[model samples]
Target: MEGVLELPPNVVLRAEDLSVVYKMPRGIARVVDRVTIDFRVGRVTAIVGESGSGKTMMASALMKLVPYPGKIEGRILFRSDLLGGVVDILKLSPKELRIIRWREIAMVFQGAQNSFNPTIKIKDHFLDTARAHGLDEKIALEKACKLLELVKLDPERVLESYPHQLSGGMKQRTLIALSLLLDPKVLILDEPTSALDLISQKVLIDLLKDIHERYHMTMIFITHDLPLIAGLAHYVAVMYAFKVVEFGPIDKIIRNPRHPYTVGLLKAIPPLRGELRFVKPIPGSHPDPVNPPPGCRFWPRCPLATDVCRKVEPKMVEVEKDHFVACHRWEEVEVSKLWT
Candidate 1:
């Protein structure tokens, strides 16, 4: 857990006390519960969690993309623009949001291949984005071709092919290229490698690293894959039951996790080549978000839970220098002799 990457105080985007509540027929479901995290400029912060843990909802909520019937309440602050000054995205109107989205803050949505138009060619998709953003046609085409090559694709062949013709990896690369068309300051990628094979995933990881270095834009990676995060992300936030259970520099979380939920997640990953030969899955299923348990959400599944863990909710406590955990038994988790 040594040599953790320390980011400067240059924050590009921040979500403070972000919450999302859905109005369902049965009852209201708190999908995202008071989540707060800062996206450091020119760095990759991966929000890791299991399905239904509200990782995707948190990502979309940052961009004001929460679906209808769901009410989002929070302050999304953007500080990258010096001329325009600090702006709260939550307060922006539709017209104002459109001006910043894609142009200033682009997103490569989850399963981004479905985002393409079936009837149109790849080039036309780029053209559509360019037109909507009010880019010059001739200049846009030139830049689009360059971006396609940057993603390690044959621009000549891909530009003519439809969405269905290209492979999943190809489509994903195209989406990345499209996101870069506007040269946004912050890029949000949701599950960038969910549907890819091992080889494709590796390729995408390398491509993303190259892109990050080339552009120096703030990147937020949202996924459940620990291995992928280990390879690409600089910081990580571990979430469970719509709340962040642990957060810190990636190396510290992976090497010496203090939260029981984070320990379970790390134990679940099978080592490709190491002294550790097996994996241990977490004990129980995630709690229902609509009516979560009163105390710590992980207490129902945690083997180390005590009486207080089941009675009072644990607040985020800084156990290490920069590492934080929201657990009553974090001390026991840290001193456990069995796992070591």
Candidate 2:
């Protein structure tokens, strides 16, 4: 008789062919296409793109935080109790999902200012999460205090402070501390540094990296900053309007990118001081997700796009070792000349 298979503890989170769509007043708008991604224990997977790239939407779907009227599909695999324990997240009821949030999976929100309550103190919120989850309140408060210190905040003062009383970076770190109270297996951070200044952003990024190492927590870092990902991420997923055009190791995708969109994105960044300065922008704005183009979503703006690119959706191809790209004519494109 076939029995249940058991998976090792290291493989924490997995998503296979996940998709999200918003059914608006008129019709359905695709926010995420068939996408497969994984977060191994103790590593950072960075999802990066421009605004409207659907990175945020995809992360939101992973946590089952999307509001009603939004349709999310595909398998989100978490280590389950039976058989290697892989189950479909979409099938779980609200009550079943409660276990996953804050315990198995947690999120560090993008909007630091809006994620908290102005009326409540930080300690009270910590108490709420701890008590609600059946964690001992006194122990939870101590743990929260330790987490605050881990993020380099004043554990004593920050706990007593209100959300409005903290700076942007401070609030961000406090949110991170809250996300870790349960020692979640996976932490999804949506633009964690988008609200801070350059100095504060660097400090917060380092703290996050340190926390990931200390806790062995798998992180899904959602951001629009490629340079930052190049420095921190182990794996990179490049997103366009609701689709991933390329996905690979951070170095491979940055150094010898294949997709036209990916290539353009790399070139668009301003070089560091003392390095050769260059600037270029992706030729076109992202198309509307509600009414996307028939062929490749990036074809309209792709400088190297051809008839096939314009008329047919490009399938993700492994042109090199462990590197995946979705472009009709990767061989014909000249990124060096076009982008230069």
* lDDT digits (tens) for residues 88-188 of candidate 1: 78888888788889988989998967889999998998888899989998899999999999999999999999999999999999999999998998899
Q: 44, model 2: CA deviation in Å?
A: 0.6
Enumerate residue pairs that collide in model 1. none
lDDT of each: 0.87, 0.83
Candidate 2 lDDT tens digits, 1-340: 1354333466667767888888888767888888777666677889988898899989998877777778888877677542226655667778778877888888988888889989999999899999888899989999998999998999999999999999998998899999899988788999999968998888888888787777777889999998876667888889998898888888888888888888888888888876775587876688888899888888778777678877889888888876888888887766677666
Deviation from native of the Cα of residue 142 in model 1, angstroms: 0.9
- RMSD (CA, angstroms), candidate 1: 4.9
| Model 1 regions more than 4 Å off | 1-9, 80-83, 335-340
Which model scores highest in TM-score? 1
